[model samples]
Target: MTWLTALRALSAAATSENDLQQVLDLVADTARTLLGFDFCGVLTPDAAGESLVITGWSGLSALYVDRVNTDRPVRLDSGSPSSQAFHSGKPVAFRDITAEPEFTPWGGVAREQGYRAIVCVPLVAGDEILGTLNGYYSPVHTFTGYEIERLTLLANHAAIALTSAHRLDQLRQLNESLREQRDALTRSEQIHERLLGVTLRSGGLDGIAAVLAELIGRPVLIDDSRNVVLAKAGNDGELPDAAWRAAANIAAPQSSAPVPVGSAADPTRRFSVAIAKLSDDVAARIWFPARDTDLDPVAVRAVEHASIVISLELLRIGTAVEVEHRLRGELLADLLGSGAVISEQVLQRAHRLGHDLSRPHVAIVGALSVSGEPAETRLYQRSLSLVGDLVAPYQPRPLAAMHRGNIVTLWPITDESHESGSAAADLVQRAIGAVSRTVDATVAVSAQAADTATSYGEVYRTAKGALDIAVRAGRTNTVVELGDLGVLGLLLQLEDPAQLVAFARRTLGPVLDYDDLHHTDLVQTLRTYFASRHDRNRAAGRLHIHPNTVTQRLRRIEQLCSADLADPAVTLQFSAALTVQDVASLN
Candidate 1:
């Protein structure tokens, strides 16, 4: 066949043949038949890109193919002609194989195969050198310019065909991947719809757990912060006690490490805990059996989605509770802030709210020492819950409200005239004990109980003043009465915050400035030191550092501010400034 006729035939076959190997084989056969070469071979790089392998061959002997294939992979070394052409992206020709110095070892093998001259044309696609098309001549022959051009054209065609086949394979893989993603998304959507349906139809956590158990093919258990199981589903005879106990010890929701309680070799009897937090106060865990569960990406994604739905449900419950609490808070505020005119309408409204205005009552105010909005909110909620339990003992049901980050309560005095004085002091002492169990705070109560004749507004103001005194006297988390705050009480009477702030700035400004410039905790250290009654050991323990460190810091403070902490007068001034600073911070 003529070269043009051969080229036309190969182009037609390449258009029809989708098989990459068949196109390569056709290229080799055409090169041998149309170009009058003694032998032709098509070589391509292997998967690892480190070597070339003979993939197609035509007009070559069995011994040649066997010897080459037996060698398996031909490394891309400088001694090999195919590697030279492939790396250089240009044709490499040997006019006489025996005359080429690099062909000393392979020249004898070529002579045995009846080839003395050779040419290697790189099969290139863009910047990548895929392989080479090699032609051999028995008699010594120099490749002319015309022959080289024809051979280059044929190799270019082969490169285009190889690139097309590779792209076709990639397209097929992409289509398969897209199909898999669509199916996964559809499954997730179906799970979401089922969960929503269960939420609407059953309207309970147990029903949601049952639905999730059925969908995920595992037992599902939901628990509150106290580890009391609220709902359960698909519980077989086997109990996951180890996972359950571990989850109870977890203060915060997290993916905990697997807890092993069985014999070390018991592989089938293990569980992993993945938690889904529902709210700041509520959380749930999905205990998956390590042996039976796959824990694939899809399963993990489904668990995450279930956590979101559970959070929404918990938030819904909390919202309803807040609405009730808000009504109670509004009633409590009205009772405390209202005047002494005991109208019949006011008495009836107080009656429905479970408050008795006729009986003598002592007002108690509790303030937390923590900072930040979240911390304050947590303290407020926890304090409210504790107070509710504390006041159950005292009758004339306690009225409570969270006002300005303080839990204010009005406890009824059972014996109005005789026992109101001692009863108020006793109530204050009991409240301090209860508030300490959850968070650190200061508790104070009115010295005298008030009835309809005295009015709730006067009692509330007295209780508020006692609370302010308790905080400023550096007696936080302690119960105090109005008389206990001696000089600080007189100082707190000055309510102008600007005057208070200016006094604090003038007193502690040098120490604060030194702290800011040095990134030191001198302000906190100084406050703690003075609060500990100048006891270096107590302050050192609180700071969690050495006593020497505290002593050194105190000396630095004395030098920076030119104030001696040893002097009682100077210590009194610093304490007063700190009190003012603390009160201003709360505002």
Candidate 2:
């Protein structure tokens, strides 16, 4: 084809062709065919623009092309024909290459390839030189003006096509990058929206965990500061307890950023964790048993968002629990103090808290055997917690409360408690076991009439009185029940201290007055003698006095009371009177 036709074809290529490599290849082939040369090659500037590298070649050996592109590329200031044509923006011609000193370095290449005449033309698009186009002639010949002009025209057409193609490629790449960024943003918003949905639904820790696990495609576990698992998902109902236990003990994180419990690069330990502090004593830890690659940014953000949702959920739950405890506490206080019938609103409230006021319940009261006043509210609160937990798992669950410096339980009657105080005894045993593990040492429980209290106030009062008697008598970590104490139960049930004193005075009144006036050991000797079963030596040993001193005191007691110590009936009367006196003193 002629120069004009070839120029038209190249112009068409500039409009139609978008591939840079295809444009370069077409330029090289058209130059070699139209210029009647042995070989032709197209050179483009490298990214650094310091040198020209061969991008397309026709009728050239691959070995030479490779060397030109790599080992010995054409530098813009290398003084070679291609570099001169590019810098000067003009066509450079080398005739009779065998004798030219400028072509000495490429002389052997020229001879081997049978090229003695060469021409280099810069491919210019407007003011910028995009690259260089070169043609080699085997025969030595001088180029006509028309031929050089035609070659220059071809280089101009090639330059325009190359420029258009380069810009098109750039636009295409920019479009691609923008598309990828849009896709990433959509994915991020979706993740955040899903997590927000969980919070809006008030899905507790388990719900948060399930959604996060599904989003991240791994097992998720949530634990508190106490190492107890609050929720878990996607573990197939099995997890390494030791691993989670250790993970829960992490340092309280100030931020909710995800922390790696184990390196993702390490196969044995692959866990990512984030923490949310629920309170001063509690923290919620989120864990992921992920695979061997670090979590992507999306997954990391999901974990952080989950930690935040967990914090909100815990706050909501904690506030609800506090409100529930306050309401229950008020109800229990009224029940322990009032003898009136329970109102409907009170029953409904109790039902909400899982209490059945209609059932037959007995009051059990327990107190610590230690003597000092229990001034700290925390101590009672802890004791109440311990007591409540001890009886929480029973059927028809009992209601427990802290009342009047003691742990009071309203236990529901069952067949197992057929006997009076049996259920109370069991409750006391459980309380003792539970309190022993707490900061409090132990407790003494009392239930006077476990199945027979006429009113709520009477139930509490009898239990309270018996607990007081038991604790004063050093009965720690045990139960006190009237049915188990035989006749002593009757003496303990005496509600009047003056009546007890009057009965004691009726029997031992004469001797008691004489001992007080004379300041003698007669009453003490009588008690010791009876306790020793009339053994004078044993009674003396007990009082640290001689047998003769015991005999003298006993005879003096008999003279004062006008009673016969040798009579069995008189001895029984003294025993009854002394028992009443002792019970009165403790009461």
Candidate 3:
């Protein structure tokens, strides 16, 4: 074949989608035809580097090519052309093969194969030396320098082709990876949409559990503290051994807390069990199963998010029910008169309903200026919510209603040992403290009643009086006990606002004048002193003034009022004067 024909054949072989062996065969045949060689072959390094395999050959017996020991290194110092060309990264030509010591072992075989002279060229690309290409002649011949150069150029072209094939393999692998990731994302989106639709339509916690189970394609079970099943999905039979063991471990008293189940099986299949405390007497347990897939990370995360939503809904529902029950009890109380009959009915109802109302209780009345029709209703609802949290533990069965635009709650105590009047006073005080912290409002507690009947009337009166005092005194956050008022308490007991104001003027008129003339806080100082029980040190500390200053002021106060400081009767008179002073100050 002519050089033009050989070049055409090489171009076609390079472009063909064929196996490496077939391409190597075409290259060897083209090289022999173009160079006019008797024999030609290609050698490639084996993986272990112990030998070079003859991948393709032309003009040689298949048996002889197979037997060639190309693996062992041929020494260049011994003057073998093939070994010299491979090590030097250049072509080598031998005009006389028999005279070369390095060729002695393989010379006989070559002669038998009808080859006497040989030329070899190294196949190299960049810094990589892949192998050597060899050609043989039928008689002793000398290769021209031009021919050796041409063979080197051919070898370089082959090396470039091999590098291109390697790069293509890498790109194919990367494409496959991206495809897998895209497919995974699509699957995740589908699962999310389906799960969301199911959960939304669920009427309660049970629906939520069903949706989660369906999404995960696994079993789920939910129960309350009584082990009564609230929801179930997937398998209805007994749980698997692993699941059962997990449940048993979490069934312990201390294990009432949430347990992340299935975390042990597959780190990615992270199922969890959670027990939520609804009230002191109520709790719920939920089981979440993870999806079984290679995408365990995604499945586990989705299940965890779903569990959180379920837990929150369950807690909200439980709280709402408690509030509803309390409101119902309060409504029942209001329907009956706020008298003895109502007290007896409440006690009897507690016994019949098996509710433990035998506890210290108090009536708390909360007054807030609610405006905006919608906002006012919401505020009242929130107030009921607060009352439920406060009374649920005591089983007081709070009765609530909107009385004169105020939220009034009558908390009933069935325990005969607890004085209703005292209990009511304490409850009002606490309610004021708690409510004030939450809102910019004043709260008051009515005096505790003897029973439900007396409680209705007394609670309203005390609450109204406390609220009036709170508002008039400019006390933003305060808990006032009507019983602590002494003479003022008696006036409040008689519901006489006019007498209360008159007493204030008689006792505090002179002190008020001293304050006006000196531009000093005598009224404030006097109130603090009285509140501290005449303790000068405590009064000074509260006022952030020197104790001596408080003492001097108290002496001046006694002189101005013409009251004896050493007499207990006079101290009582001054204290009553301060209490009544607040009533006038409020107005």
Candidate 4:
């Protein structure tokens, strides 16, 4: 057949939408016929750098075809004409395969394989060399220029077909791979969603831990700061010494480590430790075997998910604990306000809420005259602590409350009378003194009530009264007793501002004159001074003023009254006079 006829036939076959192998077979057969060669075959490079394999052949036996690897690499840099064509990116025409220097090595193999002459043309696109198209013959023959050109054109067409086939094959493989990856991702998401749902519904950390352990196929344990075991799975044996060491280090700081856990002879002795800090005072560590086969990616993911679940659970439980504690305090307050007698029932309820009921109780209340910011909170806590210390010796334990932003506390009081009330009031004054030393504020103490019910209310009322008096009288650090103030206490508790002001003006006429004229704060100074038992340091703290200022005000008060405050009789008269004025002004 003519070369043009062969080209026309191959083109028509290539456009027939036939499989690649069929197209290759047709081309190989057409080449053998048109080129007058006994043998013609298509050889493609394999992945490995080895000999090219015959993909399609016209005259080759089926045995040779079965033995070839289509993906094998061919040595194209050797001196053979085919190698020359491959490396030089051109076509090579050989008259005799045995005579060519490059073909000498393969000449013997070719003779053994029944081949004589061979022509090779490289299949190239852009700069890349894909493989080679070859034609072989059993008889040695000189190829004409026209025949070589025709063969070269045929090789180019074959190269285009092979390239297209390779591309289509690659696209098919890629599409299959993408489909597999997408399916895997969908399965993973489904598993994650199910696991999340199970964790949310599970009762505690153990449920989540168990689920994670099952999912990851590894042993696990969860622990809190108190060294309490929250959850565990797998072997029940104690953690190896190395693992314990790792856990200890993790507790100190957020970190991870691998430590040997088993026998020295064992190759799989290491455990991976992951630490996460939940809060300032809490942390968790996860330990899993570090052996490659034991802890896979799934195990790693389980550990991660478990950490989140445990952390969230801890936060929820901790918040609940705190809320329950606060609620107990509120309930106690409610009971006190309800006039219920303090009994074992109330004590048990308090104990259950984490309160030490054995402590003697003294109720105290404080009001902030200024904004309640961070600093104020600190001050309030400190004040509560100080009050706790003062009341601690009197009770088995001490507890304080911020009853609606007012500082209130209860002390275990064994004795409730005038003397005990005096002592309680005295301790409160000292607490107020301590608070004043740090911040500018006043505090009040109430007389001890006969029982918890009346005592809590009385202390609350007294503290509120004292706060009101401090604001109006411009006083600080003073303890006020409702009982001691007599009818005046009733007036102070009456919620009448005019009554309070009138009483203050009437009773302290001389002191007010001095205060108004000399711009002295006698009323406040006197109140705090008396509340502190005339202790200059304590009074100054309550007033949040300089000790020297307290001293000056006291001096002015004595001067204006022209009375000797040093005399017990005179002090008593002044106290009674103020009490009367306060009561009378109430009307």
Best by TM-score: 1
Error of 4 at 307 (Å): 6.8
- Alpha-carbon deviation at 363 in model 1, angstroms: 4.7
lDDT, model 1: 0.71
Give the C-alpha lDDT of model 4.
0.62
CA lDDT, every model vs. true structure: 0.71, 0.73, 0.62, 0.62
The RMSD of every model to the true structure, in order and in angstroms, is 11.3, 14.4, 13.3, 12.8
Which residues of candidate 1, in runs, are more than 4 Å off?
A: 1-80, 93-120, 126-151, 197-208, 221-233, 236-287, 314-327, 340-364, 370-378, 381-400, 409-438, 441-587
Cα lDDT tens digits for candidate 3, 21-43: 66677767877877788899877
What TM-score fits each model?
Answer: 0.55, 0.48, 0.45, 0.44
lDDT of each residue in 403-437, candidate 1, tens digit only = 65667777787765434644554554455345445
Worst 10 residues of 4 by lDDT: 251-260
lDDT of 3: 0.62
Candidate 1 TM-score versus the reference: 0.55
| Model 4 spans with C-alpha error above 4 angstroms | 1-73, 126-128, 202-205, 213-230, 234-265, 268-353, 357-587
**Candidate 3: deviation at residue 399, Å?**
6.2
Model 3: residues with Cα > 4 Å off, grouped in runs: 1-186, 217-298, 304-362, 365-445, 448-461, 464-498, 516-519, 524-551, 562-569, 582-587
Candidate 3 worst ten-residue window by lDDT: 369-378
